[model samples]
Target: MSVQKPADPESEWLRQARAGDTSAFDQLVKPFRRRLHTHCYRMLGSPFDADDALQETLLAAWRGLGSFEARSSPGTWLTSIATRICLRMIAKRPRRLTSGDRAAPLRSTAELGEPVEGAVWLEPLPDGELADDDDPAAILLRRESIGLGFVAMLQQLPGLQRAVLLLREVLGYSAAETADMLGTSVASANSALQRSRQTMRARTDIGEKKPVDPQGLERLLQAFVAAWESRDIAAMVELLSDDVRFTMPPLPAWFDGRAFVGQFFAERVFQTPWRLEPLRGNGQPGFACYIRQAGDDRFRPGGVVLLSFAGGRISAIDSFIDPVVCRRFGMRDEIG
Candidate 1:
């Protein structure tokens, strides 16, 4: 079929887009962009990878417009294209393994490893990107879907199996549709889905965190920010659960238990006077942490700290040491 397949009821913009109209192409893809990006993020477990995959998918869709058969809906078609792009990306890159489980005890920050060079760790998505709409209440995605805990669990599955589980389970696609997207038979898709579900069940805690009060969220965030900036290890320790997890990506150490973590912070973290800028990430409260040394004129970007909450307590803190993640939070390089 030519680009001029006008009767293709799927995308009015598709017909114009096929006829070399750039605006029509923009119209055709804008509706799917955010969702497509999220899909890629789910499959790949990194926002940067998702951005690259989405761009590649759109480029592929643009070039392949002449082959657009309107048998499937536009969203499905875009999803099919995007999923394949992520699959290819996954094939080419090394998946960032979570080292928290295998990590040596984090006795001190002196032992923290250098950034593993490339994307060698699971990264987070800004919760702001979860929904296309500005009003968060209107968004339909579950907290579990975008949570770092869940995304890290997703990283353990094989790429296609991950795609199958995401498509069939999370995205609400039928087995047949998921199979089509994966270029596999329905039986294979269902088998993969079963295996993925079993693996996830065995490896990860699948319970979703219950919703918290917005005012409570903000209050806790403000308190945590104050506590952090004050460099009061005691105050910061009070905000954490007894079993809270502290993980810094690209560094192979994770500390568990409030007393150990509290002691670690008191001895290591509080040594540097910090300036924290509050932010949001992975649908949770986050901070852009800056450190001021004795002679430092301004506080420089040290890391991005992401906090996950459960039952009115901070349950987890993922501090990304990678500078790219810091930039993704859209903060200035230094705080004066």
Candidate 2:
């Protein structure tokens, strides 16, 4: 009897890729890219950083493919590599506050138009990125996790804690699985998960979970744009909830409630002639604010503002004035 050898799984494709078959490698990697990016984003909290880490992870996976035994699925292997890369990056970076950490406290509707400053701005994830068909629950979980508050809370944890919490809670990895990914004891992983949960619970009002109505949100946002463009202070004030919160980050100050917002806008923001160019942002309503140069009516890009709505009213307004942030949001120096 002759003994026949079994064909190697992935051997054909591997050979093709090794021979510079770009298409084959792309085919193998295409499906995982978005999910990998989402994972990296959760770990890093910065889309830019996630892109960088993803590049590194893919390159590492490609280079190390020879040793990738089929013991684990390709997705699992990629996730493990990406997780390690993010962990290393996080360890090197200085700790900063998450967007939620700096979220302005809720205020009454009368404070709606305040010109508050000095909070680190939190940008929203693109709607397309958040709307996943494969896993609805996971998508919602991811959205909530990426909220300014959640990101801020994440920043409070140590690098490893952040990774563990993201893996266990956000990604739904079990304790043993996370232990394997992070190369820690299961007990250590569990401990990190517990600590992360406790910190998040302590910092945020977890019980205040409110559902966002997308259509209603859009209506409120459209009204805001119309009012602001028309400089209708009354209209703008009318759209704000009684306890709307206004904060702009990288500055420490924030204004709570509508009266301060009204005072700030009436006294300062509306004092200047400005134009707003509408833009979609953070899966919600947004605008590019432009200031009309003195003696001229033409509006030059001033900054970007992204609105967050809660309970049918604008609750949080994130203003990004940094030139770098403007570039990231795909805004030009001038919008005509």
Candidate 3:
């Protein structure tokens, strides 16, 4: 697709990149890399998968550098490549399973089943891996796009529809642009978007999300860390919404309502002494939980706990048992 030269701003970098300069390639790709990585993550629902896709996209972009025509801006071009990569990946793999897939609701610890091996649970993205907090997109990023729940809901759609919705809605691509990227007619792109929107709206509880006060959440999280470390069940209960949900993914078991959630914590979670190191996950407050077992004095890696807020209380607790997630949060096993 040889075409007109790129815009003047990109011309020099494009020239350098095409002239066998790796530095120029880095200059061309670095600015869009994080957002593209995030786009991959949202598309795949697994950070690890996203990493692979992003790497492949960068490599492809590097190899195909000279063929670039300015049909789209650099960022869009890179993202389109990443999106297509993720679509191909999704077709080759199993869809990510969330707690909603369970056949029955788990009410107690005994009902907790074994972790489903090979089940792809939606992995949380670190806030650092996301766009800047001050970016206009960051406002929507928190309550809508980057939330674990939203990402989980996106999994309901087929890869193409998911890509359509994200490109049209989240990334603000026009219908024509989206269609071009997906290699579909505009009508089909619009149709897929309409259907995906309806499905997503029905599947996601966006209404329950309130504007998060950054300062308020930080203070609340501080108290939360204290209560958790102290094993103060009452303190923890005081901060929980009456209808809170607790889900430990890959286990396919979850409990609803504050009472049951609290009971699960009191009976099972707090039985072990824990030390939580605060971290941010999916643009929300979370922690890397460490446990000191009965026979072991050294605190061992338990799992990472990601919390979601609603109505001025803790609404959801998404505890990921994946050691991969722990490493993502930069936590080590056996914290001394």
Candidate 4:
């Protein structure tokens, strides 16, 4: 007697999805959501923009499913759609930039110029939002790809070059696969990758250096948290690199050098009582800051700060102080 064979899960989902089963479509695409969201964030450099692009990609996928030839896996197909959507978004919107990227550092922290309008600053992705991939290589890839420094450098590249570099180097797509996704020839994709690498090298030491030891990084972060919570500006200064940078984005002002950053912290940042809840984001150590206002006992959400390390010291402190940013990071409005 012949026995019936079980249906392939992907094939079954594809059939249901094509037949307009929204649940099936959701299930079919669930496995790729986190990676695709990360891809969008890497391409756009803003979590909000990434959210929009991912929604657009999913909508496009739903409408175009009938044309999906199944030549590649669903993930590959979704990624192609996402890449195109991001390219369009990139063309229309201004490239996101860090405060340091906008202009020279300010000499004083007396006044943080009003939040810069019409500019999109790079945003951080909460580590919790990342995929639950246990593979060592996948973890490494996410670490290298989603770091704020790397994403900022990627923003400097033209759209095609950025896409090529991400697809080929970070995502591990073959040259031919990248070309097919971007609708170009393999030679062109290779050329874009070469140019992208050159630009990235010119901007920062992205792939050349080794990461600081985890134990040391933990110690540094712990010291920073203690100093910050205790309002010990001097102690905080001790953990900064000689050329440390302090930037509070949306505020056009940034400070360079440990002396200047320390002064800013003492005079501007620690003027109010504060508490920090340690967290990680953008492949770096950070925290959610809650501030106690004058005459108020309750601590309210203040901001999110992500730190970059160099030579066992804090090299850069990128703070997002907007209430909206705080909310997006899922910090409670009141931490008391």
> Each model's TM-score, in the order given?
0.90, 0.80, 0.91, 0.97
Model 1 misplacement above 4 A: 1-10, 108-110, 134-142, 206-208
Report the C-alpha lDDT of model 4 over 208-228, residue by residue, as the tens digit: 257778888888888998999
Q: Rank the candidates by TM-score, best first.
A: 4, 3, 1, 2
Tens digits of per-residue lDDT, candidate 3, 1-336, equal 989865664667778889998887888888898889888888888888888999999999998887778678998888888889999999999888778665455677776888876647888888878866576666665447878888888888999999999999888999999998888899999999999988986774733456558788888899889998999999999999988888887788888888898898898889989999988877677899999999897998888898888888888888987777788888886788
Candidate 4: deviation at residue 329, Å? 1.3
Residue-pair clashes per candidate, as listed?
Answer: 0, 27, 0, 0
Candidate 1 lDDT over residue span 1-336, tens digit each: 668645643367888899999888998888899999999998898998899999999999999988978788888999999999888888999876665644666655556665556677888787778755655544536466777888888888898889998898777899988988788999999999899989988984533347667898888888898888888787888898877778877767778778878877877778888888877777667888998888989998888888877778887778986788888887688888
User: Compared with the true structure, what per-residue lDDT tens digits does model 2 show for residues 233-296?
Assistant: 8998888777665555444445667776665566667777777767754434578788776686
Looking at model 2, report the run of 10 residues with the lowest lDDT sum: 112-121
lDDT of 3 at 213: 84
Stronger candidate by TM-score (2 vs 4): 4
Report clash pairs, candidate 3: none
Task: Give the worst 10-residue stretch by lDDT in candidate 4.
Answer: 203-212
Pairs that collide, model 4: none
- Candidate 2 at 302: error in angstroms? 2.8
Task: State residue 217's C-alpha deviation in candidate 3, in Å.
Answer: 2.3
RMSD of each: 3.7, 5.0, 3.8, 1.4
